[model samples]
Target chain A: MEEGCSCIYSRMASRFSIGLLMILAIVLLMVRVLYVIYRCGKPLPKGVSQSFTTLIVLGSGGHTAEMLSLLSVLRKDRFTPRFYIAAATDNMSLQKARSFEDSVAEKPAVKEASQFMQIYRSREVGQSYVTSVWTTIVAIVHALWLMIRIRPQVILCNGPGTCIPLCVIAFVFKVLGIRWSSIFYVESVARVKKLSLSGLLLYKLRIADQFFVQWPQLHKKYPRAHYVGCLMIEF
Target chain B: MEDRENAKRVVFVTVGTTSFDALVKAVVSEDVKDELQKRGFTHLLIQMGRGIFFPTKCDGADGSLVVDYFTFSSSIADYIRSASLVISHAGSGSIFETLKLGKPLIVVVNEDLMDNHQCELAEALEERKHLYYTRPHTLYQTLKKMELESLVRYTPGDGTPVARIIDRFLGFPDD
Candidate 1:
C-alpha cells in the first residue's frame, strides 16, 4: 500500500512540475513582449552625425498623398538610401514617389538614394474570407522576404493593410534580437474620430515606436497617439 | 456690374475616386443651377467620377451658363487651382486640396458611405470656419447661404514636430 501511494504521489508531482513550467513560459513571453515595447525608443547609442536607412510604405490614394507630404518635411540627408514600398497593384503610387524623388534630386547634395519596391497586397477589397486567408499568408511570406533583404533600421507607414504584415515581421525581429526596425505609424488625416484597422493593431500591440494622428479628437481618444495636426499641407 | 458679369467664376464639382450619384444628380438640378447662376458663377465643371448618372442638363446649351464634365482626370490639381469655388464630396483628398488652394469649398457628405469618418472631417473643418458642409438634399440651401468672405484661410500644418520625433527616435541629438 505504501509503494502504491508513493507511485501516485510521483505521478501527481510530475504533473504539477509540467503545469509550473507552462506558467513560467507564459510569464517569460509576456515580459519579453513588454520589454520590446517599452525598451525601444530609448535613445540608441549612436553618433550625432549618423544617418539611418528608412523604409517608407505608400498606401493607396489619400494615404499615399499624406505620406508624401510628410516626407517633404523630413531631412533627406538624415534619412538616406530611402526605400519606398508600395503594393504591387498600385503603379500610380510608385510613379508619384519617383517623381517626388526626382524633385528632391534637383536640390544639390541629394544623391539618387531612393529605391522603389512592390510587395503583394495583404487583402484586396471585397475578397472572400477563405481566399483572403491564403492571400494574407502569401503576403506575409513576401513581407518576410523583403524584411530580411532590406533589414531596414526604420519603417515609416500610415494606415495600410499591407503594413500590418511588415510591422509584425519587424516586431518578431525585435523580439529575436535580429534587428531593431523601429516602426513609426501616422494615422491618415481622413481618420478623425477612430483609428484605422492597421493603426489600431499597431497601437494596441505596442508595435509602433511612434504613433501620430492629424486630428485632435483622435489624439484625445487614443492618448498614446501624438496629435501632430493636419499633415496634408503644402511644404 | 460688367466686370462681375464677365468674370469667369468657375465652380468645380468633384466626386473624387468614389461614386456619389446623389451629389452629381443634385448639383445638376434646375434649382442648384439657378443658384450657381445667381451667385455669378460663369462655369460649372463636374468631375462625376465613377457615377452612372451622367448630367445632361445645361451643357452650355443655355448661353447663361457653361457646363462640362468628365468621368476622371489624370490630375485634378489644375482644375482646382483655376476654380474660384469648389463643391466636393467629403473625401479628405478633395477637401484638403481645395482648402490648400485657398478656394471657397462646400463639402457634401455622402450619407450612403459606410464609414462616418468622412463626415467627421467635414464637420470639424466646417466648425473651424474653413469650409461648409451639407448633405446632398440641402446643398442648394447651403450654397445659397455660403459667404465666401466669411471662410477662414486654412494655414498649412508644419512638419517640424514630426521631424523632431523621428530624429529623437533615431537617437540624433537635439539641435
Candidate 2:
C-alpha cells in the first residue's frame, strides 16, 4: 500500500512539473507574439519636426567611423541633446568621438553630445554560447538601466551585435508603457550584398523603427529597408 | 616582366598589426615567389606582424637579393613610400596608406575574419580601379595578372555628403 502511494506521488509531481513547463512556454510565446505584433510590418515613425533627445550607439572600429560620419552630417540643432553610448572596452571609439567633437566644436551650428558613456559589451558574435547567454543577461540589465536612466526619444545605431540587447530593452519599455523611443538602424555601407547579423535580426524580428541600407541592391532585396546612399563614400 | 632581378622593386607584404598566417603563407609560397622573381622584384620586405610562418628560403637569398621580415615596426609609412607593389591584408589603415601613396596594391582579405566589411571595401576600390584584391588561396593567381602602374590614385571626398539624406531621415527641412 505504501509503494502504491509513493508511485502515485511521483506521478503527481511529474505532472505538476510538466504543467509548470507548459505554462512557462505559453507565457514566453505570448510575450514573443506581443513583441512581434508591436514590431513587425509596422513603421514607428517619430517625426523630427523639432529637435528631440537622441541616443547613438557606437560600436568599435568601423562602426565608430560610420556613426561619426552620420553625426558629422546632421546639423547640431536637429539632433540636439545627443547622448553617445559605446561598449566599455571601446576606448578607441571614445577617443575618436572626443577628437571628432573637438574638431567640429569651432562650428556655430554644432550641438555637442551631452554625454558619452560606455556600457559592458553584450556578447561578441564568435564567443561561446554559454558565456554569451550570461553576458547577454547582464547586457539586458545594463541596457534596461540606460533606457530607464536616459529615456531617450530616439535611438540610432548601425548594424552591431551589441545594439540588440539595448533595442530589445527599448521594445520592453515601449510595450510596458515605460517609455517611447524610436529605433533607427542603419546597415553599414560595407554590407554591399546582404543585411549584417544585427540588421538581419532587427529586420526579421521587426525591432527597428527605420531600417536604412546604404546599397540599393540591399534595398531591392529587403524592399522594406530604405536605400540611403553610401554612408562611407570611400567604400 | 623582366627575368633579371636586381631590385628596383620592393614588394611590401604587410599583415597590418594582426597575425595573418594565411596571408603570410600565401605570399611566401613557391608560385608567389616565382611571380615576384619574374616581375623583377628584388627584395620582399614582409611586415609579418606576429605571424608564425616565415619564408623557408627567400627568393634569391643566396647573394643576388633577399627577403626581409619583421615582427612589428613603426616604419610602415616609410615602407609604403618605397614599395613598387604592395601586397597586404585588407586592413583599412594599410589600404588607405597604400592608396594615399599611389602605389599599386593587391589586398588579400582574411576570409576567417568576423566581418566582411574589409572585403567590401577592397571590392569597391577594385571597382573604382583603385586597387587589386584577392582571397588568400588565389593570391598567386591574382598577383600574376595585377597591373602595377594602372592602379588609380585615391581621392578623399568633401564634407557635404552626409547632410541631405540625414536631414530627410531626421524629418528636418532638407535645404
Candidate 3:
C-alpha cells in the first residue's frame, strides 16, 4: 500500500513540475517583453555636424518616393556619408535612389552630394507569416553583420517590415553599451488611423530613439509619437 | 495630349506588389479583351503580382488580344511612363506615380484590402477628375464608358513640407 502511495505521489510531483516549468517559461517571456517595452529612455539630442554618418531606409515603392522628397530638400553638407538601405527585390527603390543621385550629378552646384550616398539591399520578406519569420531571422543575422561594418551614428526608417530586425539590433547595441546608434521611426502618411506593424512593434518595444507621425490625430492617439506635419510627395 | 497620341499603343496593367486576382481576372475577361482591341490597344502588359490566373498569349486566332504578364517586376516606372494607358490597383505608390507622370490612369480599389484607404483616395481623386476610379467588380462597366480625355491634369505639390522635416531634423531651419 505504501509503495502504491509513493508511486502516485511521484506521478503527481512530475505533473506539478511540468506545470511549474510552463508557468515559469511564460512568466519569463512576459517579463522580458515588458522590460524591452519600458526600459528604453528618451532619445539623446545631438547637434548637427558634418561628421555625422546617417543611414536611412527606403521601403520599396511609396517609401522610395517619400525618401526622394526628403533627401532632395536636405542641405548637401549636413549629413555626410548617407547610406540608403532597401530590400533586395526592391529594384524600384534602388532605381529611384540612383536616379536621385543622377539628378544631383547633373547639377553644376552641389555635385559632391551625389557621391555621399551608398545603397545596401537586405533580404526581402514575404507576406506569409512562416516564411517572413525565416526571412526575418536571416535578415537579423545580415543586419548584425552590416551594423558591425557600417557603425552608423544614426539610423532612420519609415514603416516597413524590414526595419524591425535592424531597429531591434540597434536596441540591442544600445543596451549592450557597444554603440549608440540612434534609431528614428517614421510612420507612413498612408496610415492615418492605426500604426503599421513596424510602428506597433517599435512603439510596444520602445526601441526607437525618436518616433514621428505625419498627422496630428496620430499624435493624439499615441502620446509618445511626435507630429511634425506630413511628407507626402503626391500629385 | 499629342505625346499620348504618338506614344506606343500599349496598355499597362499593374497590381503593384500585391496579388490582386480580381483585377487580373477582370483585365483578361472576354469583354475587356474585346474592348481593348477595339480601342486600338495593341498590347496588354499585366503585372499580376502572385495572382494565379493569367491569360494565354493573345494569339491572333483568339481576336488580336496580345497579352504579356509577369508575377512581379521591381522597376515598372518605365512601364507606367511609356504606356498609352495605365490600369492599376489603387496603391498610393502607383496612384502618385501615375498622377505625377500624367499618365491616363484607371485605378481599381481592392475592396477586401485591409487598409483600403485606397477606396477613399480613389474617390477623392475621381471627384477631382484626376483618374478613372472603379471597383474590381464594376471594372467592366467602367471600362465600357472609359474615355482617356476625361482624365484631368493633376496639380503637383511644391515638395516643401517633405524637405522641411528632413532639414529640421538635420538642424537646417526652413528657408
Candidate 4:
C-alpha cells in the first residue's frame, strides 16, 4: 500500500513540475508581449514633436544625394532635417555620401553605418530575393529602435532595398494606433515582376496614408498610386 | 568638335558591362583601328567595364596609339569635360552625363538583339542626329563611316529621364 502511495506521489510530482514549467512559459510570453506593447505605446518625448523633428534618410551612395536635395528644398520652414546613411562595407559611394551629407547639413547630423543593405549585381543567380527578405527583417528592427528614439512624423524612403523593411515597422505602428506618423515610397514599378513584388509589398505600405509616384505610367501598374510631381532641385 | 578646340581630338572607347568578347572583337578589328589612327586622334581612353580581365593598353598595329583605363575616379566629370568625344555604355547614367557635358557621344548597347531598350535609346538619339551607335558584329564598318560633323550638332538638353523622374517627385509637370 505504501509503495503504491509513493508511486502516486512520484507521478503527481512529475505532473506538477511539467505544469509549472508550462505556466512559466506562458507568463514569460505574456510579459514579452506586454513589454513590446509598452515600448510601442510610449510617445515621442516632450519637446520632440514629430513636426519639427529631424527626418531620417535611410540610403547611401548617389541615392543619398537625391534625398539630400529633396531635404534641402523642404528645409525652408521651421524644421531641421538630419540624415542616417546606411552604407555598404568598404564602398567608395559610402564615403562620398557621408562627405556630401556633412557639407549640406547646417547642424550636426546623425549618421549610422551598417552593411544591412546592398544591391545584387549578378544576373545568373537569384541571391537578391533571399537577401532582400533578410534585409527587410533587419530594417524593421532598426526602424523600430529609431521610431522609439527619434519619433519622426515621417520616414521618407528613396530605395526599394531598405524601404521594404522600414515599411513593415510603419505597419506595426499603424496597428498600435499611432496614426500621426507616415511612411513614403519614392520609386515606381517599371517591370511586371517588380509589379508583383510591389503587390506583396503593398501589404506593408497600406499603413502609408500618403503614396507618391513620379510617373503616370505607374498609375496603370499601381491603381492606388498618387501622382506627385518629381522632386526637383530648385537651383 | 569646336567645344574643345584647344584640346586635341580624343576618342573615348567605353564598352560598358556588355560582353568582353564583343569588346575584344571591336578593338582587335583592323578597319576600326586604322580609321581611328588615320584621323590623327591624340589619345584613346577606354572605360573597360566589369568583365574585362586584362589591363588596358595600346593595341593599334602602327604602335602609335596610347590607351588609358579609367576604373574609379573622382575626376570623371573633369575627364568628360576634357574629352572631344565621349564613348559610353548604354547605361542611362553614362548617357545622361555625356549629353550633359555637350560632347559628341557614341553609345554601344548591350541588348541580346531581341530585347533592346539600349538599342531603342540609341536609335532615338540616332534619329535626332545626336549620337552614333554600332552593333558588335558591324562595329568596324560603322566606325569607318561615322562622320564626326554629324555628331557635333547634337547636344542633349538639361537633365535625364531620372532627373525628370525627380522633377515629377517634386510635383513638376512631366512636360
User: Per-prediction RMSD in angstroms?
Assistant: 3.4, 7.8, 8.7, 9.1
- How well does each candidate superpose onto the true structure, as a TM-score? 0.90, 0.71, 0.67, 0.59
How large is the interface RMSD of candidate 2? Answer: 4.5
Per-residue C-alpha lDDT of model 1 across residues A1-235, encoded as one tens digit per residue: 9999999999999999999999999998889878998876565665644777889999877888899999998888788889989999888889989888888885645655888999998678778899988998899899999989888888999987888888888998988788887789999988888898899999988888899999988888999888999888695
Q: Which stretches of candidate 1 lie over 4 Å from their true place?
A: A1-30, A46-49, A106-112, B1-6, B57-61
- Pick by TM-score: 1 or 2, better one: 1
Expressed as tens digits, the lDDT of each residue in B65-153 for candidate 3 is 66888887757888888788899998778887888889989999887777575575566678779889998878778888988887788
Top-down lDDT ranking: 1, 2, 3, 4
Model 4 misses residue B141 by how many Å?
A: 5.7
Model 2 misplaced stretches (Cα beyond 4 Å): A1-50, A107-114, B1-12, B28-49, B54-84, B91-103, B111-129, B149-162
lDDT of 4 by residue, A1-235 (tens): 9999999999999999999999999897767545544443233343344234334444433345445445554432223344343533325545654565565545653333111223322121244676767765565566566556555555566553545544565556555556344454554212211232433364233644345454455556666555554443322
Worst 10 residues of 3 chain B by lDDT: B158-167
lDDT of 3 by residue, A23-69 (tens): 99989777765654454543234454544567777786777786676
Q: Rank the candidates by DockQ, best first.
A: 1, 3, 2, 4
Candidate 2 lDDT for residue A136: 76
For every model in order, the fraction of real contacts preserved is: 0.66, 0.22, 0.24, 0.00
Candidate 2 per-residue C-alpha lDDT over A80-136 given as tens digits, one digit per residue, 9 for 90 to 100? 677888888777777777777777775745544567888888676568988988987
lDDT of 1 by residue, B11-101 (tens): 9999988799999999988899999999888889999999999987454545667788898997898999999999999888888989999
Question: For model 3, what TM-score does chain A reach?
Answer: 0.70
lDDT of each: 0.87, 0.76, 0.72, 0.52
Clashing pairs in 2: none
Residue-by-residue lDDT tens digits, candidate 2, B69-118: 88887568799999888998987667766876778899999988875677
